[model samples]
Target: MHSIGLIGGTFDRFHAGHHSLLLAGLEKCQKLEVWMTSDRLVQAKDSRILSWDERAAELLNFIGEDLSSSLSINSLEDNVGPAPTHSEAGAIICTSETRANCEEINLQRQKNGLGVLEIIQAEYVEAHDGKPISSSRIRAGEIDSEGNSWIPKNSRQGVITLTKEIESKLKDPFGILCEGPEDDLSVAILGALEVAGDGASPIIGVGDVTILGLQLVGINADIGLIDEKTQRQKWHGYDDINQSNFDNILNCINPPGKLTPSLLDACEIAMVNYHNDESTLIIVDGEEDLAPLFLHPLAPIGSVVLYGQPHRGVVLRLTGIDSKTRCRRLLNAFSSE
Candidate 1:
């Protein structure tokens, strides 16, 4: 009698962790049934997920022909899929986080007069920081497929400086600054929203004025980093963004010209917390001027990061490879400490 196994995941941006999980299932059962979450289901969780075809191909390539021949890969439209209902599936495989779901599936199976499945748990593949490697981290550009760090963690070593040359080159990447009358700024924000669409991507605001302006335009940011000052003057414009609005509120000291390791960790935590559809606020004690350096790499692809441009209006940066490369180049230009 062949022992059958079951495992399910979005498998977006597949990595070493996923490989470990799948191999665990293959080791325990002769035939392993893999359920890849559908695109709709993935999008319901996060817009940054890779397409279903892309995810499937990546998994197939890694698993190879021998295992692929024994594997029955199906697109999962629902959470439980066929895990609890399949008669031949005697074992279920998952990581620690998904172990509870496997047990829940067993409970449902018991109710349906089906036998309970043996739950095989796979150990998590951790990154350099010892955190479990996840697709979200990969999409954020924090880690690669094998759980290797991509962005340097020693961002707090030196102060950031915006000399005349740096300022001139970065004056306009997206467009001309929109410093303006209330109506004009509002119009500009609305136009940006039109391009981005409402609730299509996470809005990350980097400064107090930019956050307040987004609030005024009726767009509450998914993540906000503010220092309570504009043009080096004390600003109390964040009254609208009360603590009650965010699921997680963090306070970190990332001096004006430097992006600290703490700031990067905070942003990563904020992104994970924001998964519940609630907002996150990072209140900076010092300057948040250099936040783009971290945000460019930490933000999900297609998310918009908003920051003020001194006298100019808000500058919106859509997170992507180009933006991340630009941020990296600017950081390299900074005088080494």
Candidate 2:
């Protein structure tokens, strides 16, 4: 008989205690087979159950790259069999909380003409506050409140990594447009609204023309308008232009910088500027030309187009390209209020 150990769970949140149990089981058995509960079974058992596909994905993510090489996961309850039994497995590993189900599983295996197998039970892990570490507890938003260290260092890092991957997948890289210093903001605004719609967010960097363009569309976003004269006068001791007419004062208050450079130079900036703040649309307007600006030291890796709009108002010209056609198809998925 193969030394296969079966582990089952809804794995809604895939916490650290679950990971520790899997590691311990794997060490005792030659091969580890993770039986993720089906969505229907999970819904029937737990109040806040994740979908089968999502549960599997979370399990795979939690296992990480190294351990995944030695383990396999499946939603067996939703598969051909009517829930997996210990007869098919060398041993079944369960937490003390679920140990009572072991007898029921064994009986079902016997009825199916398979002999009973060993049942391995692991002790429940305690949180910092003396409460049991559980998915339900974490999902209820009581982990931090109860002072429960539910998120281990590795699991916390894994969650961040998974979140970033999901965010990147959702973002449309081609939707971004890089406008040069000489390029008119009016033209860019028209182009962006034409291409991405009025919902697009425009991030105006240090420039006079770009800020004017943003105001024309009634779009208010952060503008990184630096008071060059005042800054020079105060810092460099050269008082030329009046403080009121300084370039920064004339431009928008927040002078937006290149997303790529800002992301690469500072960790906090990168996480805040580029990560999915889906509510706010981002358009970068900088001093450098569009093509070269996109070629900045920290530009994101993807193919982007630089174009100019001759007209003032938004132009919705349909491109014959297949990608653009797909984009239109995707746009139709969203319903306008």
TM-score of each: 0.63, 0.41
* Each model's lDDT: 0.77, 0.45
At residue 143, candidate 1 shows an lDDT of 69
Query: Which ten contiguous residues of candidate 2 have the minimum total lDDT?
Result: 294-303
Error of 1 at 186 (Å): 2.4
RMSD in Å for model 2: 15.2
Residue 8 deviation, candidate 2, in Å?
Answer: 1.4
lDDT of 2 by residue, 3-31 (tens): 88777777766776787788778777777
Q: RMSD to the native, candidate 1? A: 6.0
- Give the best candidate by lDDT: 1
Question: How would you encode candidate 1's per-residue C-alpha lDDT over 267-298 as one tens digit per residue?
Answer: 87787876777788898888877777777766
